[model samples]
Target chain A: MDRPTNQKAWFLVLPVLLLVAFSAVIPLMTVVNYSVQDTFGNNEFFWAGTAWFEEILHSQRFHEALARNLIFSAIILAIQIPLGIVVALSMPRKGIGVSICLVLMALPLLIPWNVVGTIWQVFGRVDIGLLGHTLEAIGIDYNYVRDPLDAWFTIILMDVWHWTSLVALLCYAGLVSIPEAYYQAARIDGASRWAVFRYIQLPKMNRVLLIAVLLRFMDSFMIYTEPFVVTGGGPGNSTTFLSIDLVKMAVGQFDLGPAAAMSIVYFLVVLLFSWIFYTVMTNFERGGQ
Target chain B: MNFAWMAWTAPTAIFFATIFLILVGMGVWEYARPGGAPRVGILRFETTRGDRLFVSLLGSAFICLAWLGLVGPNLWWALGLSLVYAVLVFRWV
Candidate 1:
């Protein structure tokens, strides 16, 4: 009996590796350089040690942004995970309805980030926008431009709309992958719907749900473009998440040192959380299996 | 020396150019390797009959409304709706 050999898949993966290195790694290195040094005009640099990092760490502004980011990510996870699961559960499992649901769920994921922002920007207007007009007619005082709470609400909603499908789709894939045999077994046992979900569906979904949570958290934490477009971090910095504030400092104010330091901190925080999530998920998988 | 114009346009131009280059590079690499054309079910952007088109449009419309409702009905509702509408037309119709 001959043993099956591992196929060389490096050719398949090399392009992706090169693309990521070029897009993510090189720019990250540039940011690192900017973080640790003081730069004068003409790109001249002087050693500043950890002064920039210290400044950012102690600043009230940084703390506020960090707090906002944490809260946003938490709220998003809380809302999206449950909502996504429910939507996936309700979707038709086969036939024409299945195709319709799948296509609808996937549409939001295809649109570009900035374009999503732009669409929301115009859609939320007081006069011509359907939503604003409807809300106004119903006597809700909602103005994202002037009210911080409204701005925050709008941003959160935008994110949910754009991303919940991703979670739903992943959950659907997990659900569909459960063999019909499992359902048949549950039926033979005369299991209640709750029991079937509790013992079978929930366990199967655990893996994909973990992936969904991590992806959503990371993306939400790094959220910049949509919220930036919608509110411009405006109505007095009320909607300024870490990413928005970072962009403002780095690009808007051109405070390269502080921005770079913030970026490093931001990257590290994401990396740490991701590692923790990965560890917990792998442990859960091993236990379940 | 219009700093404001430079501030906006320069960043926008650079961003677009960078994305274009990345996409082109990826596309070329994919073409050279020629993995069995990406699953047609996922990549199909065109169809002759209008049934799929109608379904796509109606589905997108519902999605847009869902997005609007999720956020708390406001101006963004229009944006979300318009985007879904455009995507339906482009991808299906």
Candidate 2:
């Protein structure tokens, strides 16, 4: 008996590849072109070599933004991973309540980035917004628009609300995928809930958790639209992450060369971290039983 | 900001409209598609009830418009509502 292998799967993937290439690849080439060249007013260009990259590397502004990006990503990952796992664990395995929870969790994820910013923008306003009004009524001097600490708090909280659900959903999927047999075995052995989770659930969820971490890290690092909408990279430069800084360079300042260099650097950092995540996760998986 | 708006007028409006239509069209298509209730994932842990589909769609639309009202005018609200309606369809229907 001969077995049939289908190569037609490539056809299904072709459209997605082309779409990504057009959206991602072509613009990247344009950035590369701009990075090494300088243009005078009338569609004229002169090669600037590595001057732009050198300048960006030496710039304190770039360093500050990079530092902030790193810190934000770290903080988000620190908070969201454990919180998402806990939420997923608490959620009902199967019931009408499960559906409601899933839908509610998904609500924030579905909202557009710009809109999420706007929603929080209103939501944190001291005038008519619920959070701000309640906080003030409770005697808290919270004004995000005027205060740097408040701005940072609001931005971080907004991100947590927006993205924690994604981590939860991914963790939920990982949790659900564990076979009932594992639970049966654990039950037979009279294992505590924590023990079963620690031994069986944790190991099984490792793969998806790795994915969740990498995704959250990259997205948080590159976040622009939400923070931009919320803070406009103000009261000062306190909330300006690398992506916001890059946008300011590219569009606000129209310094194409430096912006391009910054983007390339940003892309590399994300790629490098993602690779590290993949390698570590795969190694762990291989080493496990 | 006004200068930026002036520069962005044609392209922004067009892009916004295009997104709106695409979302609404997708939502309608999903609503029209026949399925065995709406299963979430490979494990099929949760499924949307048929009536909840309509409620979900309406709620998403309302939320989208509310967002637009905060940051935009009528056109943006319309566009956002449609897009959110589409997301509901894609997610639930």
Candidate 3:
């Protein structure tokens, strides 16, 4: 009812349409073109059909990287969602303390991805970095560069540091938007703190948590810069995510057709998973309603 | 106009154009039928017409990919499978 009957609103979408065409559509079409063709040298292309796609699908390298990505995403979701919820819950609801908490929470997110990677890369150096040095001083063996376990730890820690704030901020927004009346009613009913949260808060936070989970899942799944900078997809490909492997294939090896095919596959996988998450969540929400 | 660097070829161009046309057609269909009432199909979850369309398209992509990976590169059979899948999705998804 709020929308105008006139169609003039569509004209406003033109700029965004043009932007998408230039930014996403054209580049994606180029990748699609490359995916189907083999390029030797001198810019000559021959039709390769689904050869590259088949190769990528059959490759153990692709499967391993995909597994690593999925595991990393799962781990981060497990850690960050609960941590974010707790952080949001503990945060003061009002006053200057709220602003302080928000600013502090937002600080890590404001740092660029590559910078976060660099920071973690240096910070996990056993020789010089505070965290690594302290761990070493405490007789803890920690060398991200030398050990796969340490590398995984550093990468996971870095990702959690970089992205947990996003979940927290989103959940905070959800928490604040919850009416005071609900809390008051819960109090009047002599509900426990757990009951208040379980009944009054979690239900209200369902939508925002969906957004957070999807965003976190997608971001962590496609994560490249931080993990790449920190571990360089090592110690020996342990931290090699889909994006890292794609970059290694496309730029490092210059296998254009195979890389492009992998890119398409990766894109489709993300799209499919995101859609599934959205559908399932919305369906669940609908059932609840 | 100057898209030579993108290495546009006849087949690729046609492919993308087909996708574009399908999207435009979908838009037109939606505009014509304003109320896209959600329906519970054989999948047991409620889905609108657009959702069914999306499921069909995404599922078709997977089917084609799986066929390419498992069977030979002769995509004719894959396309046939995709068509049948799409029809089923639209009809009973």
DockQ comparisons of all candidates to the true complex: 0.01, 0.01, 0.57
- Cα error, residue A164 of model 2, in Å, equals 0.8
Chain B, model 1, TM-score against the native? 0.32
Per-candidate Cα RMSD to the true structure, in Å, reads: 18.3, 17.5, 2.0
lDDT (10s digit) by residue, model 1, range B1-93: 542311223333464465568557655654555442322233233222233333343445445334433443343565567566646554544
- Which ranges in model 1 have alpha carbons more than 4 Å from their true place? A1-19, B1-93
What local lDDT does model 2 show for residue B49? 49
List TM-score per model, in order: 0.71, 0.71, 0.95
Model 3, span B1-93: residue lDDT tens: 677677777878987888789888887876776556578998779888888888888898899999988887888899899889989988887
Model 3 misplaced regions, further than 4 Å? A1-5
lDDT of model 3, residue A28: 96
Isolated chain B TM-score per model: 0.32, 0.33, 0.89
Considering only chain A, what is the TM-score of each predicted structure?
0.92, 0.92, 0.95
lDDT of 2 by residue, A1-289 (tens): 2222564775899999899968996576566666666765454556775567667766889889899889989999999999999998988988899999999999999999999999999999999989889999999999999998999899999999999999999999999999999999999999999999889999999999999998998899889999999999888998998998998888888887778877877776776677566656765775665
How many clashes show up in model 1?
Answer: 8
Question: lDDT of candidate 3?
Answer: 0.89
- Backbone clashes in model 1, listed as residue pairs: A119-B79, A123-B75, A123-B76, A123-B79, A124-B75, A124-B76, A125-B75, A157-B71
Q: For residues A241-287, could you state the per-residue lDDT of candidate 1 as single tens digits?
A: 89999988877888887898888778877876775676567657756
Candidate 3 C-alpha lDDT tens digits along A63-92: 999999888888999999999999999999
Q: Pairs clashing in candidate 3?
A: none
